[model samples]
Target: MGISTKEGLDIDLYQNKGRFLYKYAGSFLENAVKICFKSRFPESGSKRIENSSGVRPRMFEIDCLVGNDAIEIKWRDATTDGDHIIKEHTRLKSIASSGYKPIRIMFYYPNRSQAKKIQLALSDLYAGLGGEYYSGEAAWTYTEMRTGIDLLSILNRIANERGVS
Candidate 1:
């Protein structure tokens, strides 16, 4: 094959595989966190609330809602798009207006400066709206404290058993 054609093929393959890996990993981690929360708070699970603001979607999803708390769980969020801030702001506002305290818990923190900035903005937004944001080690600690489950330790044990590291 020609050089350009080979390069294009390689890029396409990489993009497809990357998308699958990211989606699968994120879904798995988010579901695991929800499971932990459900074990502790039997009533907690995914929830959908009206956007009250008449947003385009007209609805926003809370990954897990326990009592009055609206939680958004993520394995990692590395989006550098400025639009993300606007969307998240709207979502949080809708949650708040619906009488729920918005919360965000992300296991991994983005390393890129732009992505870091986005996360910082989100953290501030959460605080400004009377919500909470936790990422990295703090996220792990928060999950364990709230669920009475040492998630990291359990994951480590599983990894060791599978000889992953």
Candidate 2:
């Protein structure tokens, strides 16, 4: 499993405004995913969250932890940002392989089309990643969203594709 924590998690962004921005976006998405996860799998534990008092990783700290799950979230804003997704995916896989119950490597691009470009480009980054043909009535809600979606399903889909889950 990932590092056992006495509390939930601790994020330590380096910039001054970065901290505020991180919390704003992070809180939004966390709520969104928590609802989705509970609706689909009520038995699954809901996310338990915590933050660091100050910035600190020291090369040995988690960014965010949800229950027994550990996650590291990042954003990419550039003409070409494929590498960012690859790096995050690899890191999460490594953590999972090491025995973490659920390792989430979430990457999303925001207000920049609210995630349209990111969703369109998701296949480009995850070449072998499979899809579930999201044809639900509320498909459009997640089409260009950065804060809503089921992380477990996404990870399970990808993990099953790579023979991980």
Candidate 3:
């Protein structure tokens, strides 16, 4: 990191902070959703299952497991990487092989065309596997319906409290 000027150093620091903030925000949202699910389904929590697809990772983690539903929660996924679909496919298969129905809940949908295409593919993949995928408004509705929690309203309140529009 060879930054000669103060402006350059500030820019680099800002970018680094942005990246960290993105990760923290995603984790925060995911955990919040999991907590809501736990409140509704006291026995449900994260689960780790062995990858039956013989993939690189030997294990796949379900964000929240309620009954036969293996849930994967995401605040947002904007990955343009094609390999992401492959990995997700493997993970969903592993979850299904564990005698559970795979369900994806993504709170935010990416605006990029490539990312949107990826999400569409995932939705189709889930449907093909007899699973379910929910994103954006549908994800919010599903969470509220399943957990009896108004997550969007709660988030809006928190944002208002934090002086974030």
Candidate 4:
């Protein structure tokens, strides 16, 4: 008998094609946030830096930076890995240390009955992570949304009052 690389599997186990949806989902969310803020207030100064190829690696390049606020938009699939947790830890630390407010907006793909429960879960996770990573005042808010459209009014208000704080 000859050696078989495929073994008993009918499909290739290792492939990079599956990640495109995640990438697209992230871009879609970023654009949706940007559009929402811009449409509501024309001079909100909201910009999309998600796909920006900066001169150097950004230590904490959030999705949208308006005024003194750093907004991070996440498109989650009901699962968070270690790397994601660590990255958020560092990102929030960087934002706070840089004297900017850190605002996290998470969009969960899976629908659940109690949105409050999901929000509380995320808030608890961030609370622990923020406590360990950030030393300064944690004056940030963790918002969980079932859909990107839910962020329109909230983001608009944040962007509009960016300079106030």
RMSD in order of candidates:
2.3, 17.0, 2.4, 12.1
Q: Hey, what RMSD does candidate 3 come out at? A: 2.4
Select the stronger candidate by lDDT from 1 and 4: 1
Sort the predicted structures by lDDT, highest score first.
Answer: 3, 1, 4, 2
Which ranges in model 4 have alpha carbons more than 4 Å from their true place? 1-20, 41-58, 77-80, 109-122, 125-165
The candidate with the higher TM-score, 2 or 4, is 4
TM accuracy, model 4: 0.47
- Kindly report which residue pairs in candidate 3 clash with one another: none
Better model by TM-score, 2 or 3?
3
Model 3 lDDT, full chain set = 0.92
Q: Write the residue-wise lDDT of candidate 3 on 67-151 in tens digits.
A: 9999899999999898899999999888888899999999999989999999999999899889999999999999999999998
For model 4, residues 1-165, the per-residue Cα lDDT tens digits are 563767524234423344564677467756775666556545554342322222223644555565666665555434444554445455555666665566655555435535444445445655653422111112112222212244545655876889533
**Alpha-carbon shift of residue 85 in model 2 (angstroms):** 2.9
lDDT of 2 at 67: 43
Per-residue lDDT for 1-165 in model 1, tens only? 556988999999999988985888678888889999999999999998888766667888999999998999999999999888888888988999999999999999987999999999999999998999999999999999999999999988999999987
Which scores better on lDDT, 1 or 3?
A: 3
TM-score for every candidate vs. truth? 0.89, 0.32, 0.89, 0.47
